[model samples]
Every structure is written in C-alpha cells, then in structure tokens.
Target chain A: MSRKIVRIAVPVLVLLFLYVPILILALYSFTDATQIGAIRSFTLKNYVTLFSTEELRSMIVGTILLALGAALLATILGTLGAIGSFYSRKRTSSAIATVNQIPVINADVVTGFSLCILLVVVFGVSKDSYIPLVVGHVTLCAPFVYLSVIPKLKQMDSSLYEAAMDLGATPAQALFRVVIPQILGGMVSGFSLAVTLSLDDYFIATYTKPATFDTISTYVVNATRGSQTDIKTALWALSTLIFVLVIVIVGVMNFNSGRAQKKEAEKA
Target chain B: MENNQNIIELKHISRTFEDGFRAVSDFNLEVKRGEFVTFLGPSGCGKTTTLRMIAGFDMPTEGEILLNGQDISKLPPNKRPINTVFQRYALFPHMNIFENIAFGLKLKKMPREEIKKKVKKVLELVDLEGFEKRSVSTLSGGQQQRVAIARALVNEPEILLLDEPLGALDLKMRKEMQIELKAMHDELGITFIYVTHDQEEALTMSDKIVVMSEGKIQQIGTPEDIYNEPQNAFVADFIGESNIFNGIMTGTMQARFAGGHFQCVDDVPEGTQITAVVRPEDIELTAPEQGQIRGKVISVIFKGIHYEITVQSGRYEVVIQSTKSAEVGSVVGMKVEPDGIHIMIAENNTNVFPVDMNRNHRLEFNGTELDTSLTQLIKGSRRNEEHELLDENGEVIDPEKIHIIASIEPQDIRMTDDVDDEQVLIEGTISNLIYKGDHYSYVINTDLGQDFIVDDEYLWNMDDRVGLILPLDKMRFQVKK
Candidate 1:
C-alpha cells in the first residue's frame, strides 16, 4: 500500500511543481488586479483588453500559423523518414535513427545559435526572414515526430502490407491504404507533439525571426524582459486563454480516443 | 493435354534466404488442375516457404514457376493469378465483412454491382451469406477465417495457397475447417496448395501429400501410399506410428532382424542391408507359442478406441494397438505379417568414414588408429606387419593411395555412460527424440557436426550428454568402388 501511495504521490508532486506557477497566473488573470501579488475584485477587463489589442492578436495569429506550417512540414517529413528507416537494412536504419536523435537531444540554445549563424552568415539569409524561423522550428519538431512514429511502425504487423499486395493492391496503394491507416494513431500524436513544441519555442524563433515580426512566445519574452512597465496585465489573460484552449483540445481528443478504443475492444 | 491439366508447375525451384539458409531446394512439382496438395513437415522444413513461392510472395532463387506453361515467378503477388490465405486470417479490421470480401474485386476495377455479386456468391459458398455489414473484428475466429477465404475466392484465382490457414484456430474449429476447406476446394475446382505440420490434417484433406524435411522433399505420394509405403525412415517416422528397425537382407524376400529371420516382400539384393517399417496397428497380439516374436508387456494405455501396448523383446520394443488390453508386466506374444514389413535403403542411418592409414601398420579411421597387418590400396599390394607392402611374392612395396569403406546400422550403436578402451567411442548430444510409435529414436549430433541416429529401448531425454559405443564387429568394411 505504501508503494502504491509512492507511485501516486511522485507524479502528483511533480505535477504540482510544474504547474503551480501557471495555476497562480491563471488565477490572477481572472482578478481585477493589475499585478500578480495583488488580489482584487474579479473582472473580465483583462480578457477584453487582450482580445482588442491589435498587436496581441497578430502575435497570436502569427504564432499559430508558424506552428501549423512547421508541424505540417515536420510531420510529413518525419513520417516518411520513419517508414524509410523501418524497411531499410538493420545497420543502415539504426544509423539513420541515431542521426535523427541529434536535434532532439541537443541543447536548445546551442541549436538556435548554430542555426542562426548558418542561416545568416553562411546562407546569406536575413535574421528577419521567415525561412530561418520556419526551418528552425521544423528542425526542433521533426525529431519528436520521427521518434513517435517509428515505434508504431515497429509495433505494426508487417504482414498487413504484404496481405494488401496479395489482395491485388499495388505497392503504393498498399502503403497508403493499409500501412498508413494502421499507423495513423502514431502520426496524429506526433503531429500534436510537433505543434505543441513549435507553439512554445522561443529561443529559436527569437534568433531566426525578422526584427519587425514576432510570434506569441518571442513577443511575450521581449515584452517582459526584466521590466515591470513593459509587461502588460492583459498578457496574463492571453496565457490563461491559451492554457484553457490547450486543455480543452487535449481533453476532447482523449475522450474521443478512449471511446474509439472501447468500441474496438467491444468489436473484438 | 498435360499443360491444360496441370495448372501450376514449379520447375527446379529453390529459395535461399539472405542469411544463407536454404529454405527450399530443388523443389519440382506439377500441380494438376483442381488437385489438393499438402506440403506437410515440421516447422522450419520449408513447407511454408514453398507455398509462398507459389503465391509469388517469395521468388525462387533458381528456376521457373510456370502457371499454365507461362513463367510467373518474377511477377509480384498482386500480378499473379493466385491468392493466399495467411496463417492468421489477416482480415482488414477497419473494414466490414462486405468490404473485406470485396477488396480484391474492387482493386480490379470491377463494377460495384459485379463486385457485390461476386462477394455475395463467395460468402454464400463459405456459408456466411448474411454477415455482410458486420465488422471484421466483431466476428469470431472461424467466421473471420471464412471472410478471409471469401476475400481470396471472390477474385477467382486459378490457384489458391493456404499457409497453415487453420493454425490459429482451436482443435475442434481446426478439424471442422479442415473438412470445410476440403469441400470448398472441391466446389471451387481450383488447385489448392496447403502447408501444414499437422499430419492428421494432411491425411484427412490432401489428395497428395508432399513430405519434406530439412528443405528437401522426402516423398510425394497419395495419403495411403505415404502412410503405408513410406520411402525412407524419416518419411515413415514423420507420417504416422511405426516400428522401424535395421534389418539385413539375407536373400530375396528374406530379412534378419530382432534376433530372428523374417520374410519380407522387398526386392533388395542378397546381403543388402535395409531399414524396415511396420505399423503398430498391424501387429497382432497372441499367445507366446502361437506368435513368431515373444515379449513381456512393458506398459499399456487405453486410448478410447484401442489399447496401446508396448512389448519388450530383445533390443526392440514392439508397439501394438489392439482392442484387447494387456496387463503391464504380463508376458505376451507379438506377430507381424509379411506384407506389414516395408523395407527401404538407409541413407542418414548409415555411417561413412574415409580410409586413412599411417606407415606403422596402423589403420586410421574416424580419428582413431588400430594396429592391423591387413591393409591394401584398393587393388594394390598388401601391407605387412613391418609396414612393407607385399605383392603375391611378399616383397617390400608401397601403394600411392588406399580406398576403404565402412558401414554401420543405426541400432548397432551402443550408448553408455562410461567409455571403454575396447570400443570405438564418440561423444554426442541427443539433439532430438522422435517416438516412432513405441520406442524413442534419438538423433545425436557429435562435435564435428555429424548426426548419428541411435535406436535404443532406453528413453534418453533430448540434449542428454551421452557416449556412443560403436563395436568393431558391427562395422562392416568394404572396398570403395
């Protein structure tokens, strides 16, 4: 019983350590206070200001668009890489998988700095170009996508593809129809991971972005850099809204997947 | 006429995997149209590999796979005019039964109505006509197996390959499916090639059984022929219960074994040695003086229909199946008729040793040397005690090379826990113990990768470390031809 309590207590403690500050920020966002420490009457004025601000709206839109584009590109490339690695000879596949892990394990600051130098000084790309930012985000996300999809590929019944070909389907049709459908669950989780990573990444975006443009993460970092006056009270409301939106999205997806799993179990 | 009748022919086909393991070697067969052929063997015997070759899943490393006299070996599985029901009924779980059955037809760009008609017809043939919209995952194992069959049959291929299709089913379900599959084969009129390790399944459903072992076809014959007239000891032991013994042919229709001479119908030459096979059910239980062979019952077990009794006499234990039960430890008599004995030339059971002798009047064979003055070089002058090759005049001479041959029957091998200086001893691990109806026959592998088949009444467990005592009297020496 004590061991069971330890198992539950460990995760609970880790979750409290990770999310307590965010919970406090969300709580302050609902108050009528101008600062985090002050507890005042509750109001929606901060949310109203957040939605009405043109700069904040553009930053949110830019962040989402950048995340969507990066996640899409990374997911496509990573899924193909995973499939290629899965069928390649054992030695070659292991070598490629090892190479794919570099970006995932590399220090974020080091990767951002190296990419900045490569894009600006070597490639003659301007620091303000969207190319550098998008490429950087993809580099950060693709390894995660590759990591997720490869396991599902390994877990899949390899004979399903052969069975499809035996049933008169062409090679391409077998891959797309039979192979992809079986591993779609892994692909979806990988895409979500890439998108989430791209949304929160600040160092790469800051290093690679144009001076005139900013994503939500970079904008928030720039606005709140060691100054109380520069940081806006409405930013808390924006953070709270994004957090709630992520929670709802994750909750709905979990519920749908759980139902699908239950239905599959019943079918079997 | 032959081309029309034979739907598929594998000509000199062989398959070697990338790791250099030969799965199937020199496999040649002409499968007649509408024939049911089963490739039966233990696992890793290349039966499934041969079936996969026919289905175009595996291309033979050598030779041609001709379908109606047209080579289709290089063709992919999708392009071949064949379909395979995999070991597990690999139905598409996401699809309903209707969609699963219609998969192959839809791939051919068949019209919706035509595809539906074909699917419905095949489903009805499998006796699952009303399970169209049911999800594949929702169906029981047997029902799913039928859907898989319907999926393959709806395409109307010229031949069908089943790789242990009923392996995943329960015993009862597998038995029922065996009969159903045979009926389906008859109804479809397509050449069906099935691979399975189950001997009963092969005997029950196959029109012809191809027995394979270690990538080579041992024998190909009708079920009855394979069961009764097995061509080799492996075939006899693999197919059904049999009491195989080493017998020496003294004359035509006369053989000596089990410390007695018996009459057999085999036409082996006089003095030729052979292995004989007798079925347990063929043995008759009688009084001690009324039968030819007398023994004491070692064990008895009632097997619902008959009693399986083991009788020990001499070095052999004769297994008998009779309606009358014999008490354990009771004296009994066992008799076998002349027609019950099947004789075949021994291959693996015969030991072959190269001839080598040094100059000190020593005969060297199997890493052992023996002092002997009787040495000759396959028709050269004879060697004397002083290493002198003596011609007819007893003069000192030398021959360039000597040829010698050695042969020993498997049962002549004596396995003991201790080594003796008087016997030629070799250490081997008991690799396999195959119970050929009554007594267990062991295949022992020596350190030099040579296998020795030893038959003894003693039941040695597999992987037992034992010493083989090969007495020199049992070893027959002959000049190499």
Candidate 2:
C-alpha cells in the first residue's frame, strides 16, 4: 500500500468503529424511535423536544458552570506546581505531579470507584451536593494543565532570571516582569487544555456526581437510554457544538504559539 | 578611576584548591589607578587565577586583596567594584545590547534618563553605536566582545579585568580589536588587567609585561627589557628566537661554551657554571677559517626578510641568522660581540649557581687545580636539556665516567687547527638554502651523515666543495669525567 493510503486508512478505520453507535443513535432519533436500530426514518422532532425541555437547559448551564470552575481551579494549582518545581533545586512539585498523573493512567472505572469511596464513604460527602463532582473533575483536569505547562517552563532560559536579578530587579519583580511574560503562552495553552479535559470528563462524573446537577456528557448518556426517542438530532447538535468549541479553543492557543515563536525568532 | 592612587594591592596572594593543587604561589601585584598591565605566559601559568582572585571569584587562601586600600579578599564577585570581559564574552543571551550595558547602572539605581545617556556614550566608545536594540545573538562575534567590554566599562568600575577577551577572534579581528582596545585604554585609562597567552599581544599592548611560568612569575619588565635582556634562558627563549650556549664561568667577564667564550656581564660566584644566550639576529657569519667561530650548515629556512640557519659546531647546534644566503656543505665561520651575549646560570647542576665564579675555569687533575677553560659540563644541565644518556638500567650515567661528544658550531670560528679528514669534518653535501630578507642560511649534511646548518654573509648555492675547520673557542673539552 502507498504511504498516503495507509495514513488515511488507519484514522478512517477508527472513525468507522467509533461513529457506528452514534450513527445508529442519530438514525433512531430521526425515526422517532429510541430502540437501538429498531426503525429508520428521518425527523428533527427529538431535537425540538430537547430544546423545549427544562432539564436540558439546566444541564447545559450546569456543564458550563462545572467546566469553568474546574478549569480555573486546575490552572491555578498546575501553574504554581510547575513553576515552583521547575525553579527550585529541592521542592515537592514532582510529588504533586506524580499524584495527578496516576489518575490519568488509572482505569476509569477504578478511579471512579476509588473517588466514590473517598468522597461519599470516607469524607461523608452528601449525595445531593455538587462538591464531590467538582472535586473529582478538578482532579481529572489538573494533570493535563501541569503536563502542558511543563514543556514551556523547561524551555524558559534560567539565565534571564539571573541576569534580571543581577541588574537590580527584586526577586519578585524579576519573576513577574521577566519570567511570567516569557511563559505566558504556555499558561494559556495549559488552561485551554484543562477546559477541554473538564468538558469531556464523564466516567468520574457518573460515579460521584450529585443528584441535582448534570454535565452535558452525563445528560447525553441519560438522554440516549430510553426507547423511541429522537436521539440522532440531539447528538448531532451536541457533537457539532463540541467540535466547534474544541477547534476554537485549540486554534486560539496554537495561534498564540505561532506569534510567540515568531517573536522569539526575530529576537534570535 | 576611583582615587588617584593604587587601585589594587595584592599582598602575598596564594591560592590552593581543595584537591591540593596550588594555582598561584605567594604572589604580590599592585595596580595603579589607570594602568594597563598584561599577564603573559603559556597555558596554566596562573595568570587567569590571579585575575579571578582580583575579581573576587576565587578567594586567595593566604593574602589580603585590598581594593582602594580596603581588604576585599572575602567579598563575593558581585559585590566588588570590578567586572570581567570573559574570553567567550558571556553576555546575557536574553537581553538586547541596551539592557546589557544598562544592567550595572540599573543595579546602582541611577535615574533612567542618566542611565540612558551613559550607556549611549559607552556604546559609542566601543564603536557599537546604534546597536542598542539588537539582540546579543544577532551581533557578530567581534560585536559581542565589544558589547561585553562596553557593558563592563559603562559601569565605570575602578578596575576592569579582561581574561583573554580576544582569544576567540580570528587574526584580523584580533589585530583590529587590539588596536582599538589600546586606543580605548589611552582614552579611558581604567586600570585594565588583561590576561593572554599570546606573547605578541602582550608585547604590542601592555605598558608592563608580567611573564609567568609554571606557577611563578619568571620576570617583569617593559617589552624592551623582556626581549633584549632576559634574566634567564627560559625568559630569553620564551620571549623570542634565541641560540643559547651553556658553559662554565671563567671568572670576571668570561664564560666558556662548546662554541666559544662569551664576554659575560653579570656578577658570578667563585666556582659555578652558567649559560649564555645569543639571539640569532646578533650572530654574524664569516669565512670558514678566518672568523672567531666555526661550524657546518645543517639546514636553512628562507624567511621573507632573512635566512634562518642552523649550524652544528662542537657539541652544540648553534643558530645563525643573516640577510645573505650561503652554500650548503661548506665550512662557515661566525662572529659574536660581547653585547650580543646574555649570560645566565643554568638552572640544574648544583655546582652551577647564579653568582659569577673565578675568571679561569679550573679543572682538577688528580686533586690539583689545572688551568683549563670550563667550556663544558655533563649533559642534562640546561633547562632545554631534557634527558641524559642513560645506562641499560635507565639510570643516568655518573658525570665523571661518560665520554661526551661536543658542540661544533659558532657564528665566529677562527681556524685554530687544520681540518682532520678522518675526524669529524664540516665538509659534506649541501641540503637546503633558505633566503631571509637580509641574509641566507645554508644546510649541509656531513660525510658522517650528520647535518650542519650555518648562516653566513655570502650567497651560495647547493653542492659546493669546502674545507672545514673548528675554532678552539667553539670546541669543548669533553674529557672523561
């Protein structure tokens, strides 16, 4: 096989494998039947109904709120951890890094089961409160933020800081005025990565989430469960919205990186 | 410049590392307010160590370093009123030229407008005007070196220490910077202490040259003094091309060598051996039998200005240089005056001390003193002499038991005896001829398969029949020890 054919074939194969269920769900929603591949007819009625439902509105609001809260919190913790660990000769930044990285690698069911035990059983977190879900989502996303920031932090020249200090800049001034500006692009990308991670998290949400709150991911899971339901239109709207969001966020961050690279090249 | 006085005084400075390496011995140096002194030597001679100790990077273990009359031995490098222009020009890569120059002034908290004015002036001083906005990496190597200099000089520190700043530059750039730095020195006069291994750089730029060797200073003087009157053979050989002749002191104004007797100038002890140095330019080539010295040409190299010739006479390989080229395989004579010979005691041989000895070298004949010119000693005595003729067990032969061959070349050799055919003859084959601007050197491979080099007045070609003679002055008594 030609190189181009193989390159296209692999991703297409994975896509075909992934989209089959979603395609079936869409076809059933348009058919006005929620039974898995039970009937095949096209209609927008399910999406219209979804728009009118009060739970859908609340779910969208809750998902946005959760993602923003988790992203903001993760960004702060991860940036601090990265800078502190990277700058110091002896610091515990790596310990926090390892702790967060464990969640990324652990089986989703294992992590969910463990967090459920910790928050609901050990900490006695009430099931109706949003605290356990928010805590779980933040833990899931912080590692992503830390990972994204690390490359940028390491790339920063340490001598610039020394030069600033030698030029009479106070330690704080040198950090903020010199170091922060140089690493700002990384921080932005890390925050964007955190938002993306928090938006897509569902496994942990399913196990430990409060009763009153629902993210879009968990809402989609529950919405597609019933029989004779218009699932296709609803999912298309959801996937398109999500796809656009990802593209926009990723595009802006990459655009920032391009400008920064250009500026660095000119300096060189 | 701080005060119109001594800017630095290093009192008995000595540095020892933790691993038991002594970098510099107990050395003392003083710098005036605006003097440009250069430390010159081969690598690892402790010149850079001395510079670092002054900059407060390396603390001396056993001395007081006073800057402006205050002891600064314990001060850290950053706190001292000095800066270094490193050999690599270690400018901050992240900063532009403007920031690099303004760094020290900014640390001093000078007002922004005044800092800008001063930085601009220094940039102009280094001929780096309009380079304020350029990143350090954008500039060429020479520009970076200049920026490093301006960065240090703009601070107006009491002293500036440069550790081989031009060592990385190419030849043309180096020469240009040397002239420019010397001009800058004349204009600023900021007590510049420069370190380098290039002797010509030291000779061209320094007001004073501190010649160092091993871990100690060999000599300190003006360029003329170091070149013309080196205190020892090491200094003479290190400073310029020299033909050194080792001999025993024959009392008040004379020393005997394999090549001849040298009219000595320095004071000598009662009984000691010394070595005299003759510069190639000071030696003269004459006829084979008529001149005061005799030798056969070994090889000749043509210099643009003169011929550099190596001649083998007696047991010594003497070098003569002149404007005229001579034919190879010919016996040549040489002449040397009293002023041309610089006598110094050899460093080895416990009997050869620095003091002048008796006027006549006395040889002991069965415990009785005999009147013999002490023209020679056992080998391995001069600093240039590396190894001895050893026995099978690798032990040095006892000085009294070995029959040593002798030096045969002198720039001025007069005929004292006829040429013995069976004995060693200066007559042989002409190997090469090199023409220098004012003279020529002839190389002749002898019939004994030994090569002889001679520098003479006449211009001669290859393969000439020549009778050979060895002057008594250039012949050494290599008697059994």
Q: Write the per-residue lDDT of candidate 1 for residues B47-165, one digit (tens) a residue.
A: 98888888877889998999888999999999988888888888876678998888888888899998878877888899997899988777888998888888888888888888898
Error in Å for residue B342 of model 1: 1.0
Q: Is the docking of candidate 1 incorrect, acceptable, medium or high quality?
A: medium
What is the Å distance of residue B396 in model 1 from its true position? 22
Tens digits of lDDT, candidate 1, A157-240: 777778889999999998888889878888989999999999989888878888888888888877776464314768888888
DockQ of 2: 0.14
Taken over the whole model, the C-alpha lDDT of each candidate is 0.83, 0.72
Off by over 4 Å in 1: A1-19, A31-34, A39-43, A117-128, A226-231, B1-4, B348-481
Top-TM-score structure, candidate number: 1
Model 2 C-alpha lDDT per residue in residues A1-268, reported as the tens digit of each score:
6999999999999999987866655455555555554566667766676677677767877888888998889888877778777875543666766776887798766777788899889989898888878788778877778787888778866545644443445667667766776777777777777777777888888887887677888877776675424443565556655665767977986897799799889866
